[model samples]
Target: MFNEVRRRRAVQRVRPGDGRALKRFRWWQLPFRALFYLRLTRDDGRRTVCAVDVRHWRNNSSGNVKACLYVDGRQHARSGLPAAFPVPGGVVEVRMSAFGLKRCHYVTADGAEYQLVPDGDSAEGRRAHFDRRHPALSRGVGFLSSIVLVVAVFLLVVQLAEQLTRADGVSPYVGAFSSPVDLSAWGNSVVGLITLTASTERALRLRHSWLLDGAAG
Candidate 1:
């Protein structure tokens, strides 16, 4: 996310001109709990839209609210709006200033980021491609599963080690009591080993040619 306070300062209008500009300036100065909309245009003919709909107050609240529209390494146009722009669907189209080169860059608003690419002949196709490549739900689930697995393995190992140490001082008999305890210990040890092994396998798989080859197939 780009810095919101800096964005507002960068885009703040010295004197209001367009309706969009006025709305954006008013929106940027709003209190934190209020909802706002921001539409940023670039120097080149590229537009990226975003909205700020948050309810948290902070010192320099404007810094918490960011809106950026970039072209190449430079920021062409940007805005910082307070949280109260009532645009339908909370979407605003960024417009570019006249006479500039179209280049690749990114835009960020209210923690939401967007890339501004050349509007090709197949605009719909390009958008679909981007959507397919960035499936938020799938990525989130995978991240969460990795975290859970790591935590579960750590807890399992701690519990298993504690139980095994206590059991080691007990009888050497191979009867029913001994058998269940041994089996329990074996089961826990196997689980712990498997968890550690799986983690190692995953790490290796990340850079493994075999995984890539299988995927290519």
Candidate 2:
């Protein structure tokens, strides 16, 4: 129910594009830019390509980002992050996270969902290519990332609980608790780096969980 309301609001935020041509993805823009495409055939049997473009490094101080919708290389419509751009058979939903894009799916009227293809030169594209070319290796890497995030989250929870229990008035009500594992500053930094890499790996695949990625972000 809440999801539908949020979708409706995002739809309302959509604005017509300025009709500028979509530029090719440049290599230097690899870190900041993201582009994804969806191809669909209309009722008239004509096929059209839709693209979603985002520049991660170009957001406001509030971290409010925007997503642009391009049709056959022409700008069509655009909206803020968490946008839903109306298309022929469905809406193209685009969402972002601190690490990168977490969702960019074409949702059909009948409720089916399809993810858009990332631009070939982009980081996400490279990650996806690796998955197709080396499925076993990719799975192993993905599994490793998941495990890293799980351990990170567990440590975070335990530490947070310990902090809460040691707080001024809190320990009186809730008995003091100590974390099973304590890390030095250097160890914490290494854990942080590992978790960041894991989250980025998941983001490349558009895999995000509010509990995992959200807390990490």
Highest lDDT against the true fold, candidate: 2
* Model 2 misplaced regions, further than 4 Å: 60-63
How well does each candidate superpose onto the true structure, as a TM-score? Answer: 0.20, 0.95
Candidate 1, residues 13-65, lDDT tens digits: the string is 21221223212223333222222223455557466443332223332334533
lDDT of model 2, residue 84: 94
State the lDDT at 49 in candidate 2: 93
Worst 10 residues of 1 by lDDT: 95-104
Q: Which candidate has the top score in TM-score?
A: 2
Taken over the whole model, the C-alpha lDDT of each candidate is 0.34, 0.91
Q: In model 2, what are the clashing residue pairs, if there are any?
A: none
* Candidate 2 residue lDDT tens string, 134-176: 9999999999988998899999999899989998899999899
